[model samples]
Target: MISQNTINTVFETARVEEVIGDFVNLKRAGSNFKGLSPFSDERSPSFMVSPAKGIWKDFSTGKGGNSVKFLMEHSQFTYPEAIRYLARKYNIEIEETEQTDAEKAITDVRESMYLVSEFAKDYFHRTLINSEEGKAIGLSYFKERGFTNETIKKFDLGYSPETWDALTKEALGKGYKLEFLESTGLTIPREDRPFDRFKGRVMFPIQSMSGRVLGFGGRILTNDKKAAKYLNSPESDIYHKSKVLYGIYQAKQSIAKQNNCYLVEGYTDVIQFNQAGIENVVASSGTALTPDQIRLINRLTRNITVLFDGDAAGLRASIRGIDLILEEGMNVRVCGFPDGEDPDSFARKNSHDELVAYLEENSKDFIQFKASLLMKDAKNDPIKKADLIRDMVTSISKIPDRIQREVYTQECARIMDISEQVLVSTLAQLIQKDLTEANKKQKQEQKPFEVLRNQNPKNTGYSGGDPDDPRTGPPDGYMEEPGYPQQQQAEKVDILYRLERKVIEILLLYGDKTEEFEDVFLKSNDEGEVVMVSEKKQYKVHQRIYLSLQEDEVELSNNLFRDIFTDIIGFYHQNEKFSLEQYLMRLEPDFAQEVTDILMEDERLALHDWEGQNIFTKGKHETIAQYVSETVMSMRWFLVGKIIEELKSSIQPENSDNTELLSMVMDYSKLVNSFSKKLGRVMSRYH
Candidate 1:
């Protein structure tokens, strides 16, 4: 168990901007930072981070929270893991109570899978480095491939022994369940016996972006014609190859820092390029590109350069992935090596500078590269030439942004020696066809409407319970039951938000401000009725504000106002003078999220140029914090007046003069009048 002190230290020491900035590319927008939403496909910046508040809000998805919540949402890390990650990043030593063996045995399935995979990685590495067979076969193969010891260890390269049951027996003997081994595809189970899945093969552990070992890719050294040369772990709860790219964990920082990614085909390609000093490179491990993988890269960089071999198959694969890349609104450049040379061979044969220069000089935009490469083959054949134009148009049409599509179309027309009008017309047709197919698929997959009865009139009409009922509500649809009137609710929310802002502002900006106020005390009348009386005591303005509210029966209308009022009452009862910094620091995460939302949300007023209107914006009253406080007090008094009216309507004439009720009403009325006068004074001062 982690102690409270450790949690506090983690929260205090972990800088939110630094933590979120690792995964998101944030640009300064006013006082805050804005970035494209990592939770959704967005072109414009909608994800906002407030460093002052230590929180972030995704307006598009409505997911807002502190730094810990962001990690949980973005990286899928458990709470403990998130805390540990932050601790590691901040260099905080964790103090945790040791867990018993029995407690550790009851681990979650996903975490258990992770543990098993990690064990396999360690086992494989030991086999490669320490075992004679592994040294002779796997280590030799890696050395021949020009992989340094540091690179091999960094990538966690390993090898499984030649004996079939060596790994299976060892794992089973260690109390690691055979079922998990089979499920992770690390062991092959038969009727009589079980064997190691990647026997006699060198292992390349594949990891997720967060650096958790998800799966493995094994390469065979022997010439076994019956067996495939390379085999990979099957998809499981933790390992989805389509959604993962090898070397992403190592390349994420460089990719973000450089704002570009270099994509290649195999593990060796990634190693060679990184060893050649190109750090922002990842490999697909020879699989067809997937959208999930593209999005993973998209989160880090807006541009990608695909490094392909000069072979025909590599060219075909590159072309297939171009449309996917374009559809994601990413800029793509293609670079093909010399004939019979892959990225692995080319990088090894050339120096770092030579490879860097070659890439810089040879990289071409997708459309230009495709047109130049394919135009020669379709020179004389009219049908083949027409097909080539259509294919290019099809790729252009896949682009989601219209401006980008149009730009690509113009570039293609110029490169193909074709008329711009013809190319534009063809692109239009292709777009229409794509949209038609998309709409058809959407319609086919859409659920049939069964007419569920509308339960919430505030959201939807049909309050009679039948959705098909024509007479359920007005044609314009069910409006919110006018909860306290739209103008009143807006005013109330504005006032409460303003008041809280004022309190926070005063606390933050002028925490030591001292002013004397007449202390109001609650005294009991003869008939057990409460009466308010002002005493000549020089209390601070902040203290007087709370005492006046507590001594009088001011009914709060806004929920937030009522809550804050209750909290202040409790705080005043416990402490002589509340610590504003401690209050903010000790607020629960949920309350903090709320406070941040209220502070950052629109207050529905424009005062940026108000000073030019001959209005002398005075000290305190002119500030946003003072304005908020006045607004909250006004709303609270208004609600108090309404509640008094409701009570009066319910009272009988005989009870009108009752001392208890009359005194209560009188005290409340005084409080309401006091707030009204304060609000008026603040507004008049601002004007």
Candidate 2:
């Protein structure tokens, strides 16, 4: 395990902006930096990095965190992986606690498995290059397939000996455990004896995106009728076939740099394509296309071109993958090689320049490719053409972008010689059906949460107390108060969100800075008129915000915001000596991002030097109790207004609390009447 002290050193030395900048291009935006969100497709910049807070936030996807969190989210790195990445970037020496034998044996299953896989990879590569039998069979097979000697070692190509126990005995002698060997699927255990799984096969080491050997893909050289041609590593903790793409480790950089990915169908296809000068290519490793695989590529580039042989079988595979790509909002293109040539054979046959030219010239959008592929079968048949149009519309509907759908629909209509209106209407029907089913699925999944909330109404949405929405009441309530819709109940929760969130933001950012504020006291006069009295008070921002929330007995409705506010307040309460950097370092990646977002919101404004404009912007040290009180009162007014709405909708207005709420709403109205919109209560009955 990594020592906590080492983790702390890494955190302290590493600047979040510096670490994230390696992956994203960020420009100065106020006191912080802003960039396009790497996690989503957006035109304007929404990803913010707060150097002061040591965190970042992607407003687009609601993802935020420190350097470690960004690495984990972007690269799918585990916590340890993320920490190690940051440590390496910052040049911090990783100091790990030594593990005892018992400690090591207990749960280092994954680590041990990784080590064994690495050892096996080296063993197979050596056997293929050095062993006489392996040289004659395995090495020759790779050479015959047009792979250079450099390519062989680059991909860690190897051979498992024909002898069943060769790998097993070698691994055992090398101090590797038999359990990990079997779990990695390197060794198959039977009742009689344990033996190597890929015996007599040429090995292809399959790697994770981090370039670690996760498993192997082996191809049998023998022509035994019953034996399978290819054998892949079984599903294990480290190797999930559906989630792993062959050559991704080598191709990810090129894919991101070129802004395009060339997806093929086999290990040889990927390797040959790479050798032929196309570095940004990944193979499906012979598995059927999966969404997880598509998502893996989506992280690197939004454009994908599937290269298939000009054959019916290859065309089918391309069609199957196209829908998935479009569903992810990716720009997908399809290219078919000359007849009787797959990616491997085609690349081997053509020169590098020729191969590149062919791909560029032939690549077409999936819609055009699919239309052509199906049109051959639909020729001269009116019924078949109609089915083809429907089929094309169905594929178009899978696209999430409305504009893309409309363009494709128009294209499909022109190609099929049908009315664009007909295709559009058909698409609408399909989309509606899809949405209905998706809603049903969501409701089914939410059934448990719904049940829990029903039992605990206080914690759930204020469904029973408030109107369906601020502007609209239920039909029963509408009948009772005809003007209710016109009155609009007046809940500007955005104003509340801004005010409440501002209080928390001030508390977190300026917790240590002392500020004086005008405090308001509410009282009734001798004549029964409400009166407001003000006095100046001084306190830290954190203390003031905490006290205000406590006095009001109010909590934020947004779960993430509420959780962060609670944690920040609690931290300040416990650790009187608040260190912003130290506190930020202790926060989890996701929550830390929230704190950063709050602290860094509109930081560009602060960073832009507004003092030069003769309009002073409040700094952390600025004393503005009046400003703080305005924020607190706005939130208080919003809550009071919400309660008044509840009271107006209450069945028993004559009840003391309901009657009391009416009088309180009226009293609050006098204070807000001038600047705010009209506010009133609903009568108990129409009469």
Q: Best by lDDT, which number? A: 2
Model 2 has an lDDT value of 0.78
Clash pairs, model 1 backbone: 495-631, 495-632, 498-628, 499-628, 499-629, 502-625
Model 1 spans with C-alpha error above 4 angstroms:
2-5, 100-106, 173-175, 435-450, 453-458, 461-625, 653-674, 681-687
Where does candidate 2 stray beyond 4 Å?
1-9, 12-52, 56-64, 69-81, 87-108, 129-134, 440-459, 462-582, 586-687
Query: Candidate 1: RMSD over Cα atoms?
Result: 7.3
- Candidate 1 residue-wise lDDT, 315-336, digit = tens: 9999999999988888999999
The C-alpha TM-scores of every prediction are 0.80, 0.69
Residue pairs in collision within model 2: 30-604, 31-603, 517-625
